[model samples]
Target: MSAVPDLNTAPTLDDFESLFVNNRDLDNVRAHLSKFNPIKTMRMARMEIRHSAILAWLLNPQETHGLGDKFLKAFISEALRGHPTAMHPSALQVSQADMMDTEVRREWRHIDILLLSPANKWIFVIENKFDSGQHTNQLARYLKLVQSSFSKDDFSHIRGIFLSLWDEDPDDDRYAPINYGSICEILEQQAVSGRHPLTAEVETFVKHYLEIIREATGMSEEQKELEKLARQLYRDHRRVLDFVIEHGKATDFSFACDSVFGEGLEHGNIVEVDNERFVFNNCDASSISFLPQSWHKALGGGKLYWNGCENWAMGFPITMWISLTVDADGTSGKIRLMSEVGPASDHEFRHDLINGIQNATKTNSRLRIKFQAGAADEGRKYSKIFKKNFFNVEDVQDQERIAELIKKALKDFRPEIDAIADILPKFASYGKFGKSGE
Candidate 1:
């Protein structure tokens, strides 16, 4: 059957003047696009294009899902049009088969598309997704896989390619897409409203990339297919719009959410909501608790005892950077002393025994600290963690109370030596580096 008719779609650079890379009126731009039949605007399916583009355009680059990613994948393949090198040829293969289902194991490395260039001794393997970074490694991996499938003789002449359209690891070979329709007009709006750094970078990149993408706009089969898809999407959305205006809201909004969900989850309780989300309604949280101790005495601590020095130390892996955050709001900051133990005396802080723990108790309290000496590669490193992450924050008034308690506790802590001039009062000596204490 013949495809639905698309809007004339003869886009010119002038048509998208306002939507140019850095021009910022994004909301109006998107509103303008919403008026167009989306399928006809991008020349693709309405259901397929608009919804996916919305997500890919709104969220973190690594988080786009479903058809948005599929369209992105298709769009990237379209880039090979004007691009040429000692690698891929101008004409290439699309979604060509890599693995014939062995009458069994179905979807493995179902690579989105592959462009094999006999002339330039290259092969391009592509995997696309709507918005996020999940497929970051796919290009290199799929390229390697495709190359490995060939006999060693083919390896010498074959080079593989992996292309992704959205923001991926900065190292990926990305190019600015020179869009030409209502889609083109919307790119600037999409970037601005979304505040996308990578998309904003397009302003800098697009001017330079014009020649490359102009050729790509019309060259290969992938571009043609994409153009066809874009047209179909535009036509469909237009029909939807007409229907909506006449009848108010179509019968379908979250139309295929269920089918999409079923494709992702297999067993009980795993519901496919979106690419990055899941609803686990059946999970049992009651039986979960900490591991019991000294099932160890039964196991008779041999290798396992020293193997876990947790008894002798606060055992847990820590990052190279240690953070100590403090919060002193107003009404709620007093030490609920552990073991009826109040704050420490000067002797404890002076002796440097658990000074870190003591310093942490102070709201926004800074410290000049020395580790047990052998703590780091060069003795010790000083670093700071923001308050929200590190400290036990209390209301600002409570903080004063906590401090008052510490002062009361310090009255009892007497170190063997009182003449040591290097140790200063905690807050009095607080400085950036431990140097402030002295």
Candidate 2:
């Protein structure tokens, strides 16, 4: 037998690096290293996650790992035909044969991605969305800009594309909808066909990008293996990885939230749920209690904690209380006025609340109350009095703006809340029916 290699010496850092990088297939290296690249790991204004990356890749044909014009051509073809596959050879020739220029966030209009053909004629406007909904009439504004720039006769088809992870109908019918699934399919075709053969290095990069797009579109397999591998790697290098993550840049939403709510939390006006969650407790409370873990499990995300008057439930067979919830999530922030009656045996309590609301409506027209009659088995009956979604979570305004709005909403509705709290327990117990003894 040949001499046995020494197994006792621990591997050096360089040796480990070589073990991971050397003699490995290019695709494997790319798949493993893509997430660590500066474009992904570093924070930059121009990079909006995958949004800017997609545009940059499309714009630069001579850059490393560049996808040739065929991908752009295929995308345009799909936009024109309103389907995945091209109609015929002639469909590809709808635009000029050559790509002249590409611009991102072009002057005042600030279009996301703009592709232009030579002779200042044909233009293709692409608006890409990953998880965000379109702003009010953004597509129409873009269309108007493009129409005003070039006359109808000067260009072939001044096509507007709404490229997204999922198919969404554009607000304006003038824009065409195309999803990443079609783009992935076209890239896969190019990879396999070898008509425009890509070098191995570029092929690996394209495959890495395709996988990301596929995962976003929900076309790829669940990333269990990758997740498992990542977990193991993190486990092995917990100290180093933890330090990196701790110092790493926070996302746009996270940074904005820190700027908006951080001080309020420090001052105790906002209560913390976790790093990502907080509730504005501007509601003056007589009682506060932690929500049971089981309740959280059953209710999922919307409800978090509970607060109400201390003696509101006294002298009633069923527990009844009036309260307001300061609830928030990524999409919206709201203050909800509510009255809950637990163990609702029949629908009579709801009818009583409804009658009381109608009576209250005559005196207080601003009060909008909804009675939700819950089955006994459903655990609780609730009457919603006031619900206003005031601010969007995406808009990163100053903390003062959000705090002021929250304070105003709570203050404006205070009289109504106080009125209902005083009347609800009394009205729910004996409003419709006579006293319990009688």
Candidate 3:
């Protein structure tokens, strides 16, 4: 049983039934709804399904499959009876039980769901909305927060998504460039088809934030592509604990004496870092170690490998490995870090930072770096390589060329961030996250 429909105040019971329960002709329903008032089309998502049972009944008119579907039934039964779960979640959280607050500068960080990879890369933020609207400053704030605390590992991939209702802008593309929209939808979009959980503006707003992340970072295509590849590799896993045990410190974190791939057995020379942090800080190798292997006896199964001279040892934690097509019998892609994990390792911050990565395979299949040479200086870089032996352009022209290069560099990061912003309006409602003006 459910509360009586407030047909006198809004659309009639017939409208609700046709739109959901006996929806054999959705396009016709949409067409009718559009012609009836037009405004109803945009406002329908704003209505919360207060009575899950009633909602379910609306979804299944004639007892179709005994109880219709379990998820829908469960969601409806609980809501109607007064128990609520994540399905009809209540997320007007003030602090970091959400992702909106993380990106804003100087705010005390409290990540809702923090993802830590064996390589130290993390998707540290997740935002939720009830509807889609033009995204607010929240998206930008999250990106800024990550940038502020970024390490080589932080750069591996900072993921932020809007789990909300539907898009505010009906005419715009409904997803981020990559499959980011799909990922967000997994968590935000409503079970009901056509009707999003949130609003369109919220999705657009989130996408705008992603654009900011991509352009501001100025990451190279090669690097961005590499990172994209690595994310795909680890998306479905549960835990990934690993360690370099030892690498150089931040002030002088550079290494690379020789080749770690010159011998006997093979999978090709593959270099992998936690996420793609080809850099590291000083650590007391003697004090560094793994999770004792026994701790995760039942989690899953992977592999391990290594190569290097006796003095400056090298090895791979099965948790930090990546599979490549070109790796026929152990030719390229092998990895080597410079250090040893012993009894006295650095423990100030148990995380790594990364930058300059991309996805070389499917949008879902990602690749990670096993290690970078101690000599790889992690710094801001320009994409195009100037091969000219000399510069003949006038000083002003050269200045403008440099400016154009800077602008072009900024343009590249847009794809990643924008991809994220595209899917934000499924779970949350309008006016959430304080509505940004810009």
On lDDT, the stronger of 1 and 3 is 1
Global Cα lDDT for candidate 3: 0.26
Give one digit per residue, the lDDT tens place, for model 2 in 271-349.
Answer: 3422222233222221122221222223222222112221333222222122222223122333222334433334555
Error of 3 at 386 (Å): 70
* Candidate 2 clashing pairs, residues 3+ apart or interchain: none
Error of 2 at 369 (Å): 41
Location of the lowest summed lDDT over 10 successive residues in candidate 1: 283-292
The whole-model lDDT of each prediction reads 0.30, 0.49, 0.26
TM-scores vs. true structure, each candidate:
0.23, 0.41, 0.17
Scored against the true structure, residue 408 in model 1 reaches a CA lDDT of 33
Candidate achieving higher TM-score, 2 or 3: 2
TM-score of 2: 0.41
lDDT of 1 by residue, 1-438 (tens): 956534344334543443334543444445544654323333322122222334233222233221222223333334444544444323244223121111111123665444343333344443433223343465556656776775545434433333223323323443222233223323333332343344444443332232222323343354465466556544534543343345442111111222323322232233322222222211111110010111111222122221122332111111111111232212222222111011222332223423433344353334222234332222223222122222242322232333444323222211201111122222222112222212
TM-score leader: 2
For model 1 the TM-score comes to 0.23
